[model samples]
Target: MAAASQRKPATLQFFLSAFVVLWLIAAAFPFIWTLWGSFKVELDFFSISDWTNAITGERTQTTHGSPFTDAGYYGAWIQEEFWRNVLNTTLVCIFVVATSLTIGTLGGYALSRSGYKYVFWLLIIALIFRAMPPITLVSGYLPVFFDWNVWGFLPTAIIVLVAINQPFTLWMLHSFFEGIPKELDESAKVDGCTQFQAFRQVIIPVMWPGVVTTGLFSFLLAYNDFAVTSMVLAEQNRTMVPAIAAFLGTTYTEGNVMFAVAAVVSATAPLFILVMFFQRQIVSGLTAGAVKG
Candidate 1:
């Protein structure tokens, strides 16, 4: 009877593992297919004649003398100046993440430690702001930006992104701060440290994982934003997402779809690397926030 029970559990475990593997494959197949197609000419990648052409790269071989070619990348990055858009995106992300985290860390810490009843109301207000769609907020900012002649600028976009991202950071970091014991702060105060010194030297070190997790989230917001960036940024100041959209073109103009495909691959590769590098911290940070000591 014990052997039969063990056999049942073993079978269940095998099935569970198989299910996870299948799910991962299903989730990954689209990006994997797109990555493969990024290296081929449009005709081969999007072949209506034979769907197998995407896999075999028959036309790609004829056109480029190889099954793979870098022409799309060259066209997007060099000829069309996608590098400039990449640089703009980098600057926007840096500024947005930095600004959001700075404000969030400070504000969250204060609110978490405060003795005031008003803290609840303030957090509720922040939550309301955060819950609203970002696009709704963007429309309000447009008139002011145009009036200030600050429209279509990197700083303008950065400022807007920071505003959109700040409330989330504040909420996340506040929860993290709450997870930390107040005893640590008292211990630092007894050790001749000021409040700021305690926060900077002791509390922040412990809060590092939470900060990293929050920062990563803030980075993603600014990195992946399409609506705000597209509307606020001029053509010359466009970021990767908007630039990639431009590569797709509209009814009025022709677009290089392969360039967009190649650019998509280029844009997505870094995010995977970042998550891999920070995976441990992310998991631990989330775990810490969810569980109270």
Candidate 2:
């Protein structure tokens, strides 16, 4: 009986292991394929003749002598000035994350401490705003932006992204603040610390994990946004994602599809690095409020 039971469990474990392996391959294959193809020429990468040409770099070998070439990267980064877009994206992310966290921390702390019934309704309204698509806001801003002549600038895009990120930031930070003990702030107040002082000294240090996680999301929003950035930004002031889109439009027709592919791989590298380093903080922040005492 014991032997039979063990056999069934072992069989189940084997199937589960196989399923996990397949799932990981499915998830990782696209990035692996893109990275591989980025090193090859368009003909071999696209490979209409034989799919193995994509793997073997057969046509790429003919053109470049070696199987791999950095021509795509050279075209995008050096010839096309893709680094300007990278700088724009970095600046936007910094401004948006900083601005969002500043406003969100204050507002969330206030909401968590206040016992008013309106606070509940305010949170509900925030949820509603968060649910709305960002594109919907563009129409409303177009007239104002055009009239003000600030439509395609970095500051304009940064403000819009910060506004979009605020609702979610408020909600997340409020929950994190709530998880922290009220006594910490109260004790500081009792010792003659002003509300702001208590918040700065007592609460702020403890909230870093949650703040870091929320800031990561804010950074991602500004970094990855294509629709709003594309619509608001002009040709000279475009961010990386929109620049990549523009590359796709012109490069494919110019027989430079690999430039777009290279741009994509370049764009993805920072995010991968961000996740690798801060993954622990992300998990900690997510679970900070799960089982509050």
- Candidate that would win on TM-score: 2
Considering only N, C-alpha and C atoms within 3 Å, which residue pairs clash in candidate 2? none
| lDDT (Cα atoms) of all candidates against the true structure | 0.88, 0.91
| Candidate 2 to truth, TM | 0.93
Candidate 2 stretches greater than 4 Å from native:
1-8, 284-293
lDDT of 1 by residue, 96-188 (tens): 999999888999998998879999899889889988998888899899999989999999999999999988888888888987999999899
The C-alpha TM-scores of every prediction are 0.90, 0.93
The runs of at least 3 residues in candidate 1 whose Cα sits more than 4 Å from the true structure, single-residue gaps closed, are 1-15, 190-193, 250-255, 283-293
In angstroms, how far off is 115's CA in candidate 1? 2.9
- Candidate 2 lDDT by residue in tens digits, 183-253: 99999999999999999999988988788888988888889898799999999999999999999889878
